[model samples]
Target chain A: MIKNPFLRTFSLGVKSLLLHKLRSGLTTLGMLFGVASVVAMLAIGEGASKEAQDQIKQLGSNNIILRSVKPLEESNSNQSTRVSVYGLTDGDFARIVDTYPWAEDVVPVRILQQEVRFGERSLNPRVLATTAKYQSVTGRPMLEGRFLTESDEETVSNVCVLDYEIARYLFPFRSPINERIKIGADYFLVVGVMLPRVPIGEANQAAPGEEVTGEVILPASTGRKWFGDMQVKIRAGSRDMEQVDLHEIIVGVDSSENVPAAAAAAREMLDRTHRERDYEIVVPLELLLREQATKRIFKIVLASIAGISLLVGGIGIMNVMLATVTERTREIGVRRALGAKKRHIVMQFLVETIVLSVGGGVLGIALGLTIPEVVAAYTDMQPVVTPAAPILAFAISVGTGLLFGMYPAWRAANMDPVEALRHE
Target chain B: MAEEKSKAMNVSLEATAKAAADTRAVAEFRNVSRIYRMGDNEVHALDDVSCRFNAGDYWAIMGSSGSGKSTMLNLLGCIDRPTNGEYYVSGTAVSTLNDDDLSELRGRHIGFIFQSFNLIPQLNVLENILVPRFYLEDPGIGLVERARDIAERVGLGSRTDHRPRELSGGQQQRVAIARALINDPSLLLADEATGNLDTQTTEEILELFDELHSDGMTILLVTHEEEVGKRAEQVMRLKDGAIESVAYNRPTIQR
Candidate 1:
């Protein structure tokens, strides 16, 4: 006999459970799988949402992007004409800078699909033409040397900055600084190398064509002087001519709080001036807010699916406990006849259930943690296991055990001692 | 060593002699009646009957089936309450005590012996013997030592670690006897305690009961066999929940 009643009762419970090893093990398996799925599913969901949120954050939260789209009516009408005229002109950029007081800085951009050549290597990358303030608006950082300066833009110097991927591909063995790369018919000296940037999702693309390989930055004045605003494409049997001044304009707000208002004012100004809707506006703040809301909904859905499995596991425990109480009716009688009170019988059975569930919970947490690490190692998907995931899973497993164990314990305590002793 | 053994024996003998001189009732039942209701039909298990048991006396209650012998044993052990009247053990009325208090009283003052040697199958002999004290407070090394002493007294000292399944029917009954004596109760109640044993084993158990009776312990044995009832100092016969006759086999020493 143990001196402490608690330890004595606990040992008694363990002894009885050990008498039927296979039954107890099978019952514990239900809780094990339930908790493991909850933790693993939550981790996978959190990881996916975190990736999307990170991409949105990369785009400046206080900046709004306005892109030119060729009006469908103008393009259809110009099928027989020699040249097509549409899209944002220098006049729209000037109006936004002068009319909107919330616009802190506005940078006009032009992008041309062109191939850059270095010795025997050639790659088609987007040629971005913008001024020195583009870096400040986009928060892009340079890897080496300096960005294109004001003097470079004023003189329209034949100099360019290449993204890391482009620099590595064009100049494999040598430093890109001072190296000359040819674009179209002109050769430009490399003044700086910029770090790779996180590309925007396809929804933000202005042109529908092949994937953008990389980016090459140059001065706006240099691009206008050499290539002009008119681009002609002759494909198969048809010749298409398009004239556009600016392809994109990035507007910066005074603060994050003023971004939505600034975006609305810009839209109102464009809507009033342009007869056709030939442009699209994207607000990073709005996309971010929407993505966060979607992530919250996804978490609830995943938790509920896992919660059903836990409920099934709890039912399994209750079923086994009910059978156990019936089978041990004689033992309960003997105990009562030997002076055990009703509370003692209840505690004995409750402790047995807690032992089974808490044991399964600990094992489930281990399995849950290992699954994510294995998934991350073998696949492209990243699974993040937060500390709270395991804690919450373990807590729910224990709670399920207690909730399901109550009815059976009460039944055992309420049995008549005389009738129980007479049970076969 | 021999002198010390005789000195301890003498002290025990003197204590038994002193207890035998004091003639107080160990237990008394006054107008006790137990009724069982089966679908609006009341079955009188025990009628209005009264009895008193004094210290150092051996008694046997004999009856046929439906004679309420089982109900009487349950009531005397404090496991079941009478529907009418009151009973007292150690001068405390059983009617005033709640369920928990009755359980405590049983644990502290009464010992039970069943025909089947109702030992827990999962526990060994020593643990089974310690079951009566399992619900008591302040269990210490002294309690275990006392259990060992009683086990030796019942000639099961070598089988203390063996489960009941490994022992013979007589050995199992001996283990039950040791268990009943662990609480050192003043009243020992036995219900067909030797019914399952062979003739030889029955005589051995009866001799052990005789030894306990001579040591000034009060005992109440319920049986249907005339041979077993002849061993007690007195016998009470019950018929239809009431006493039919009271027979004295020998002159009562203390009552």
Candidate 2:
């Protein structure tokens, strides 16, 4: 078939639109926001999920988390005043090292809530007694100085890494590096300050709670010397002594596939060592799987909301086109008298609507792309622009035009030529 | 080969043509009847009206209100159909043609001129003349030059680019005439071509029509004015949807 005179028709469509610029522009605005919202919302969803994935990925797939739980065996003996301590012991730790040859690093941590003092400022913060491997495992970036090394642990150096919040409070006017904070009797040198983690998921979306925010880091050797693990006192109304060897343990295996086996093996070893249930194991990889499944639903809901706006935009196009058809009845009559067929009439109107929708789509893509950068700069949220988003939005806008333009074009095409000529 | 076949066909049609042997009518109506319904009342717009328009003949239809002259003009233009009876244009039965075929017939063979000089306000004079030809596939060779020639022929030589709103009443009518003649149609139907014009402008328009008629163009005009009727070689008067008389004026002006 001969190619229809599309360029001529298109130019004519442009001419007609130029005749009523204000009306056409107002109609275009509806489609613009519709497409823009689609792109922007999708980008935000992608960015949020990307951050969540990155946070989950930081905890290596092969890594296992085991936390200490005080057993209830001695809880009723002293009720409010008596201290009870039952958790991961040295025997369990030793047995795990002997059993799992594939387990590379067995990081031990002993945590105690203590008041840290610096000159005029004193704040209660959790003091974490852990190895330098904590930075490698958690993937938290340092803001100043350096983290504890093997040498620091071997020499039992009294150096600590201060979380940025505590550092800011303790040394308001100066860098916390090389500054000493007095914990109990000894003053420990601050080696580094950690950049705050961009806490992912529920933590960021929740209400205020007494969740752990700021903490001081110490080499395991220094913690053992300063804060003894075997001896601890609880002061409620009367003082009582409790014996706790370790608070938590992080075990890393060679590969993700070996995690289950290593975790089960470690569990067996811990079971033989402890007569009471005093430890819980968590797999970051398994938690990541569950989070991924939930995020799919979140993405769909966001996309649907944006899609609804686009649908509304299409309706706006239909409204404008119907008015235009009514206004151009005389023109249609003239065209028919000049030998235009119904197909020709349909093509003419389709060209006009396609021009409107496609114009709006291009504008919307530009707006959508810019919004992400604007949001990222002005707010804490990051938006990711995927390649498919703009293309998909553009396609939908054109489709919307074709879909909505059908009725108006049909109405124009079917009008009686004589009656149309008689129209004012 | 196709042209030879069509030429032979035309000769045979001329011999068997429904009108008189000597005068070959370009458009012929055979007992045509057109009735309109006005709320259960059947109004006979054209009650069994019969007419023939020969090639190269100039004629005028004169009628008063409710005389069915408008319906006759519409039938000539091929924009409307007769409810009953046969109408032929260029040897083809118009009643048998579909909407698209009718449009093509009008575009290729017939030209219509409205009283109001309904030139689209947006298009300039040259573009207005080109509107009819835009419907044709090839629009023939020298399309632009032909349009220019028609514009110049109608005394719109230098103002081809001027829009309808900018032109005077006479000038706009000239543009409409140029548009009607751009297709070089065989039959021209002018309905009150000089209705909205001054006496002087009407005379000028009538002279132009006379000039076209002398150039072998078949012209049919619908009007109520005796002056317009006098300009034609034949005049058909209609009263109440039927022909009253066919009068031939004495010696139509040579100019």
Candidate 3:
């Protein structure tokens, strides 16, 4: 071909790469897979962590939780008959509110898993026994009618608010408000219908949320006065009595920024008050922050793995280029004799490596974009394909090409002209 | 004759000074020595040897293998540096020129023809001819036309599209000769230009060299054959890393 003399070296670079097609292709493939995996891994990890953060945020960033676990001394499943008393006491409740002034609307709740029946329809649901402030504090808007007022708390009234799911299930055809529902021997009037909420699965419950589920909400005083804490059950020729005074206390801080401090103060107070280590502190804000930190580390680990593969690809280019320098020793000598400078020799070799790596980088980006969508389509996982991923991968590939191409190019440029000319 | 030339070095230097005054010798070696080191031993390729090549002088350097003639050819070609001493090309000291300047000097002034017809196997004849001029920015509009003209002059005008392997030894040498002449260099350095050609083609190649020499081209021919040396106006013989003799082929009758 009548190649332009200025572009002759450039064409030579391309021709050389094409000459060793298999080796070039394998090296490009190494970078291609590396970049693809990097983009895909980043997208997946970001997507997973983003979803977790969203779930935690649903519980409110300012909320803290205190869960009452059964004390080891009082509770034993191996023993047939015993009376157990543990968890948040009335005195502990008064003390927490007194110490942490930033704590706003600290709602004490007693959750009872009980079966409720109307006439013939019966279903098992959670009984959330809380105060009148639980309505505005939990932030669940009433869908119809009205929520239980302070009058319900003072009189120990037999009044309740049904969750959306239970409201629909219990009264599918007609208005269920102002109607009576029976739980065991007692009857309660349904005053309000709350909006349906996303289910709090067990994993999500690790971070706290408002005390609302597929259940009934009534005054904690009324539930305590009527049912009492001693739950006596007779089954299989044995009697089991379990008593939990207060199941959980949802403490809301005045602001999200104060959550960590409030959580620390609550923990300190609980530790000093209760010697059993029975109370576990759950601050959704703090937990979310920790999760974010972990996710950052995860991203770096993933990127590093990808970087190593690109390094391997770079080494492959270096290996092939060194062989090329040896093979073209005489050619280099001829060029030097004919007026090619050292830089010309260096440029020629560098262009070849760049061609290989850039070609691989472009292909890798295409694969990266596709893999994530394919994964999300075929599996339960959703991979967030961020724009930065492909760009970052491509940049790394080019950088890798330059980094590894240096030694071989330098060697080629520095060859002794006389000895090289004599090389067969 | 050798001792006379060596003793009265001013005689030759004066002749070069009288010829052009400002532009003296095309090439000059001032006490040049090239030593090769292999482990603890050293090989003296050229030991304190000095020579001058005046403008338009066709000189053939004849020597056997290991006589350091190839080493001399490499240094003369500006592809190798002297281990000691200075070399000047057309009054410019080569030792003072950096690598880039040396390459520029080679591009502008020196052209080479090899016995092996070392045409880049991948490039066609036309492309190979343009190799020396590649480094120039805008080698001007008539390069292709100039290349075409040179190709025709070398009798390879019809074979511009053919690769080196496709051509016979004679044709390949013509291409190398065409490449050598394309730069219109101050010196044409040929390493056994007709070594691989048949006798008939060798005579034909020598006739071309004669035509080029009479046209006022300065030529440096490094060869082994006595016949090749006989064709030149002057011959410098080397033996054991030193110059054995420098002699004129015949009395000069033409200007």
Worst-scoring 10-residue span by lDDT in model 1 chain A: A200-209
Q: Name the better of 1 and 3 by DockQ.
A: 3
TM-scores for candidates 1 onward, in order? 0.83, 0.75, 0.77
Candidate 2 interface RMSD, angstroms, 1 decimal? 3.6
Per-residue lDDT value at A142 in model 3:
79
State how far residue A59 of model 3 sits from its true place (Å).
Answer: 3.9
Residue A120's lDDT within candidate 2 is 81
**Candidate models: Cα lDDT each:** 0.83, 0.82, 0.81
Clashing residue pairs, backbone N/CA/C < 3 A, model 2: none
C-alpha positional error of residue A347 in candidate 3 after TM-score superposition, expressed in Å? 2.1
Better of 1 and 2 by TM-score: 1
- By lDDT, the candidates rank as 1, 2, 3
* Cα misplacement distance, residue A266 of candidate 3 (Å): 0.6
lDDT of 1 by residue, A268-298 (tens): 9889888888888889888998999999999
lDDT of 3 by residue, B1-255 (tens): 432344355444544544543464899887777888899998999988989998889999999999989999998999887777667788776666788888878877898888887888767788888877776544656778889999999888678989888998899899989988887899999999888888999999999898888888999999999998899999999998889999999764265
RMSD values for the candidates in order, in angstroms, are: 8.6, 6.6, 6.7
Q: Candidate 1: which docking quality band?
A: acceptable
Ten-residue region with minimum lDDT total, candidate 2 chain B: B1-10
